[model samples]
Target chain A: MSLSITVVVVTTSTALHAADKLIASATAAGFDVRVVARTGDDPIADVVKVAIAASSSEYVSIIESDGWLSGEAGAVIGGFLASHPGADIVYTDEGTVGRRGRIDVIAKPIFSPERLRCQFYWGDIVLYRRSLFDEVGGVDASVPGAELYDLALRASIAARSVEHIAKPLFIRSVQSDSGLGGIALESTRRALERHLASTGGGVVRAVGADGVHDTRRLVQGEPLISIVIPSRGIYSEIDGERRCYVVDAARSIMDLSTYQNFEITLVLDSVAESEVISELMAIVGQKLRIVEWTKPFNFSEKINHGVLHSRGEFVLLLNDDVQILEPEWLESLLALAQRPGAGMSGGMLYYKDDTIQHAGHGYYDGDASHIGLDAPRTDPGPLNGYRVEREVSGVTAACAMMPKALFIEVGGLSNLLPGNFNDVDLCMKVTWLGHDIYWTPHAELYHFESKTRDASVHAFEVDVAWGRWGFRMHDPRYWPYPHNRPPA
Target chain B: MTEITPDEQADYERDARQLALVDRIIGLEAQVAHLRSVNTSQALRDQLKEVKSSTTWKVGRLVLAPALALQRLLGRNADKDK
Candidate 1:
């Protein structure tokens, strides 16, 4: 038996020619074609509904007037649907075709709810199960420019399974523009706010004109956060002056951070200088708890010891070389960590020279590395990856946050990895247990990396990590440019 | 034979190329899974090597060697008596 698809082309009087071309192409490609005329009187959503109501098919695809089906869209979509039997909603990678040919190929990631809230990354063409469309009540006519976005959010909430096809199946006949317009941005913001309100209450603030947003989930009551820092109380030369990194880190948190209901658990080396401890105490005041590390220099072991001594609902793993850059950095991390299905949350870290240190971790080309390393902090990166809060394969433990219970549940960091790749191993463990690790640009910090210890990676550590998680070396979320873009 | 139009030919070639691309993507996904399985096997072997070279394993072997020799001697004596 074959699955049937109805292609509903929404068009206006001026773009009827393009609509005709789309109808012809869809019909030739073995899809049921329906055309809906968007008069100035009726809303676009109502017009689409009329067409959908008239058509009878297993699947319904909504496309704009200027968009047409690719030559092999039918074959690819059929094959995908056959394979993914449980998928209720499916969207494909899309590109714009002009006289110069195809360009701006948006190779979308596998169903990211966080990314969806920030922007309408899913382009114009979307295929939905007819039943799912009806279940989500078609679309809201009130959201003028973001009708599809609103529908998508509601459908995602109700969808049993949503899948993404990396292949570009939809072709638009115009050049894509940068950023959402005024009305569109406002509509998208409203849609996002409603999405948050329906799922869980959160306030959405538009970050920039590029359709990026910051979502602050209403955290229920102030949860005491335990910040665990493993330090040797060593001094680093900054601007020709010797400064204790741990003391400075503690001072930055005390002075800069807006969240006050927290304590700092410093896992100091037993042989640390008395002056360093005294400085840390004076800076952190009564909120500091010190735990002496008598064992050898094992970063994972020290963190585990610190967590054992501290008491908080959540645990924040901070490196001593880091300084808080934003007043609301902790607030951003905590809100995301408190969300449902979140295992860990991390922040963007910059180097001393204002270059990106860690945006997130990606296991590309069979090696774990930071996603956007050494790039200017102002760069919007590929697919706005550095600008939005989205799910990642792993996050650096240097500035990561998670529930204390979850930390103990994943057995903290692995002892086998004493120093290097311990964070990656911990992230892998969290992902293995089916929890999402999120990275947000909203949380900002500066990491004076490798200030206290040797940063060289060892061969044995690589062997151990690859031996355990070699299968998961490929990251699906890190779809950067040149990899996803079509031939120019 | 029926003559095919140039436009129809272009469509056919385009569709064929796209279908091939889809097939290639599917093939790559399967290949990645196969490679992952192979890598996991190699990793297990490496872990086994590490365990075998561990001090605890060496000490266990040393302590069990004398017990095994006595058991062999006792077995031979019992067999001779029988």
Candidate 2:
């Protein structure tokens, strides 16, 4: 196929140099560049349209102003599109351009049209024939933030030839100042429902039939994970003095067999005693990391601070109390967490006596004003977590694996929450945004759960049981009360 | 959205291939276990037991997982923190 993938950058009056850098990068990759800037109040669609018309190529790709295209992006993109002629448009795995340039994660979508509805999230880095726009239609120019997802869904449904490359090639800039804005996601969900309803449900059948990388499957090329065991105090309440177990946590970590990629994250919390730090250093040997945190008590706070100091994308938010149950715990967890729609994922929690602690989470409505709570006790042998792939309302944050950005996006466990409800709050907020939470039975961890010692030991759980309404306020579907009885 | 750079493309391909290799190795392990479990001859069972202990697999795995995990740490963003 004779293809010249021309990148179209729509520049505002200001960002010319950044736009030029993108053009130069694309040019270096042997792609033709066409600049589409604001021309006297012309709509952005009109601009993109004129640029697409000007490009005399079989395939036209797009790179917006303040955008990035990594090394040799064009050929890979054009090849994906050419190979899949049924696809109307092509998109690469979208993420951010951090200090390291590109941090793209596996895109795993679990809830299809049933619960979580749309995938046309970012439209800027998509590649398609110029004729696609000319034939069906183009961006409406009237819709707001989610305009592209809407337009692309329409075009994709109409043309049925839209496709995507399995590589990470795009970065949708983080609008730092925007926060979550005033838009309610439930309202967006309603709008999406209306849109989906309007198009008579233009959902595509067989999402991974194209034979490119399946969006639901996790990519496997990353190396082993190495964690830094920070110099945190290993204090046991059993004695006034600090302690280490017969088999230390660091040594236990090294014992894991499914260990292709993993690292320990050791942080030197300011409060950790020097003796304990020294002992940890002795235990970890080369694995100890003396990280800096401005002194925080909450487990969520400690983990958030520690992760910022972490190197692995697949982070293990392990508590000092938990031990690996089996050798395949990690690979099993990663395999499950790698599934689509799983933003914050965790697994089966068991007690030292081998009883189930938590297989998944729901909000506690009984004793608390909506602190995150685990699913009411279930027999671990029956494998409640292993049932099937389904959307969950919340998950235990004590041993969750999620993207660092998603953690930051949820405001890193409200500093005001101080204790028990923080992880609940984080999971609720995540699910509220229409993302799914999952619990897998395969990744079992022994949780030495010390709720009393848990920094979030709130009197509010007792108070809420007396009067206040709890988890019912946000999503009543996940309310857990005192009796452990299902709401009849 | 970002385009998949060639480096990332190569990385994905490599990761996929490595995971596939592990999957295959696991299959072989299961097959060996199955054959040993249903041994027809006492001599064959004894040989299997000896081979299970004497096989280079245990030593190879003991050294590899930690080493791989260490190399993986260098690729992460928190190399300095740990």
Candidate 3:
């Protein structure tokens, strides 16, 4: 099938040479190319509007001058469009061309509206259906440096379907400033605020050096959040002092959390000391409920029993070894979980030694592992991955929150694999039911798990997980570029 | 917003320092692990070089040269026939 696509090259006076080369490359690749020269006076959105208006192609792509299309881009895009006729907005993976060669490849995730609101992760080159573009009113000239971001946000909300081409079809110059700062930062903030205002009321706060913003949605009412923590109620020495783990966890929630409309359901083993239970009672007061687990040591069963005893609109599965760092951590997770189509939301967890424990779960090569394990908190990850909220394949149930109704709908956690990969199984069920799981960096917690890592992966659990959800290995949400591909 | 007390501020500062120290230690450990692997690889390369320069290895290669050449010739002929 023949697919006519118009490539609108948005260029500045300084990059006219690059613009010409890009146009030549696009033309060679059998795409209609148009140049929109920006004299640094008129808004870029206005020039792009004119260029798009002059085009008669069914599909239109907007790219910066310093970006070049790959040799197979036209054929790949045409094939994809032919296959997915309902795709309204399409984007591809991109890489940076340095003096040495092509370096720093960015294999972007499938269209994530949450990630887009945090940062402009959908590189410079994006193909939009002309009808969808016109429906979203092209672009907002008032957004200045963030016109494309604003357009993407508007188009994503209005588009019928958004598709991601995994092939790296766009190559950008390394010298181009993709970092958020100055006017781009201000424009991003404005765009995000506008997006929030239109979707739902939320406050945007810029976090991290990479211009990642946190959108705190204003929940309409105070829905009770039930925090389910399964623990042995054992004592651990922290900072040279012996403290009951459950009591410390309870105390941290009571003292540090800003959200008050919540309850704590401690699913403790029956062997737990009475003194520890009394101390937890003292700390949590009337907001705490103890569910004694008489069964074998099964984390899944403990959580399921905890959920059965609790009554709340939302349920948060938290480990007893965790200490809340952020005051509004509960609110942060709830805001994302409360959003439409959001299945589960997890927080950024740090080890006791401060390296990352879990950013999100990434499934690759038939194995599920933490996306950014042991990476320093200062590292924002590729394209500010760790600093922004985005859809993930799964999240560690150590601190995952979801609506109670949705949790029950997915049959809670699987009891077959009671220990390991149970959270992954639960998340897979959630996504299988067509809901997106989100991981947010805004909610910070220190997971003081034992120093000796639980390196045991039972063959039984692996077989069960692999048998049920083997298709997850093909889902590339967090894994980027070369890492996403299976081995030869 | 809840106001943070002086004690909480002190605790945060201490935790921050500890975190920085832990990060540095982890980085150093990674560097050490990388260096150890590089050293091991270099040792293996040197051993291979020594074996390649040995008289026995040279004699073996010289003896196998005719056989290898004949195998390649036969493979090319088979490919052409196919």
Model 3, runs deviating above 4 Å: A1-3, A178-181, A207-211, A236-241, A478-488, B1-82
> How close to the true structure is residue A283 of candidate 2, measured as C-alpha lDDT?
62
Alpha carbon lDDT at A144, candidate 1: 69
Q: Candidate 1 overall Cα lDDT vs. reference?
A: 0.78
| Candidate achieving higher TM-score, 2 or 3 | 3
Structural similarity to truth (TM-score) of each candidate: 0.81, 0.41, 0.81
- Docking category of candidate 1: incorrect
Decoy 3 TM-score against native: 0.81
The C-alpha RMSD in Å for every predicted model, in order, reads 18.9, 26.0, 12.7
User: What's the lDDT for all of these models?
Assistant: 0.78, 0.51, 0.79
Give the residue spans of candidate 2 off by over 4 A. A1-219, A223-232, A237-242, A245-247, A271-275, A282-288, A292-296, A364-390, A450-456, A459-488, B1-82
lDDT of 2 by residue, A1-488 (tens): 23567677776666577576677767766777788775433446667777777777766665543656766566677666657766666766555555564463423221122222323333357666667756656654544333344455555556555454556665445441122122223223333554555543322222211111111223345644434232345466543644543125565666664655665665555666666666655665554444544465545555655555556766666666567776766655565455555576676776655655665564434322211123333431211122222245566665676655555555555444445655565665566456666655556677765533434356763332222224223332322223132221
Docking outcome class, model 3: incorrect
Report clash pairs, candidate 3. none
Give lDDT tens digits, candidate 3, residues A77-120.
88888899998999988878865684567788888877878877
